[model samples]
Target: MKARVHVMLKDGVLDPQGQAVAHALGTLGFQGVGEVRQGKVIDLDLAATDRATAEAQVREMCEKLLANTVIERYDIEIG
Candidate 1:
């Protein structure tokens, strides 16, 4: 089984890194790019065969170590 976790900041939070990227893009002549948010994707290979269990485990991983729940939200995808 494979699990993919996406971690991102919640809205109404200040994202200096995202704003930096948007500024750099404009400097490079890219236009119409407004409000860019940065996030991360974590791909995991699990030995568990059950879909529910795998999702649970991955969600635990995100809550425990992968994501900063205080300022971010995460989504889990199992395959």
Candidate 2:
């Protein structure tokens, strides 16, 4: 099975990297750009055969180490 996790900063969180990217885009002639937020995608290959099991394992991984629960939220997809 394949599990994909998307991790992103929660609202009201400061994102300096995202701000820098927006500024760089404007400087590079990209106009009409609004607020930019950055996130990460993690793709994992799991040994579990059941979709539900894979998802549960991945969710556990996120809660334990992949995401900082204090400032970040995550979504999981299994295939």
Candidate 3:
């Protein structure tokens, strides 16, 4: 199975990096750029064949180490 995790800051959290990028883009003439939130993606290759089990394991990974539960949220995609 293949798994992908998308981690991002929760709304209401300030994102300095995203703001910098947006400002840079505007300077370069990429107009109309609104609020930008930066995020990360983690792709994993797993041997588990059971969809349910794989998803559960991945969720555990997120809860334990992949995401900052207080300020970030994560979504999992399995293929």
Candidate 4:
């Protein structure tokens, strides 16, 4: 099975890296760029054959270490 996890900061959280990118974009003459939020994508190759089990395992990984649940949220996709 393959699992992909998308982890991002929740709304209202400060994102310094995102802010830096936005500022840089403006400096480069990119116009009208609004708020920019950055996140991470994690792809995993798993041995589990069942989709449900893979999803559960990925979700657990996110909850435990992949995401900082307090200020970040995650979405999982399994194939």
Q: Who wins the TM-score comparison?
A: 2
Tens-place lDDT per residue, model 1, 1-78, is 999999999888898999999999999999899999999999999999999999999989999999999999999999
The CA-based lDDT of model 2 is what? 0.95
TM-score list, all predictions? 0.96, 0.97, 0.96, 0.96
TM-score of 1: 0.96
Candidate 1: deviation at residue 50, Å?
Answer: 1.2
TM-score of 4: 0.96
- Model 1 steric clash pairs: none
Query: lDDT scores for all predictions?
Result: 0.95, 0.95, 0.95, 0.96
For residues 3-41, what per-residue lDDT tens digits would candidate 3 score against the true structure? 999999999989898999999999999978999989999
Which stretches in model 4 have alpha-carbon errors above 4 Å? none
Candidate 3 runs further than 4 Å off: none
lDDT of 4 by residue, 1-79 (tens): 9998999999899999899999999999999999999999999999999999999999899999999999999999998
lDDT, residue 75, candidate 1: 99
Q: Enumerate residue pairs that collide in model 4.
A: none
User: Across residues 1-79, which tens digit of lDDT does each residue of candidate 2 receive?
Assistant: 9988999999999999899999999999999999999999999999999998898899899999999999999999889
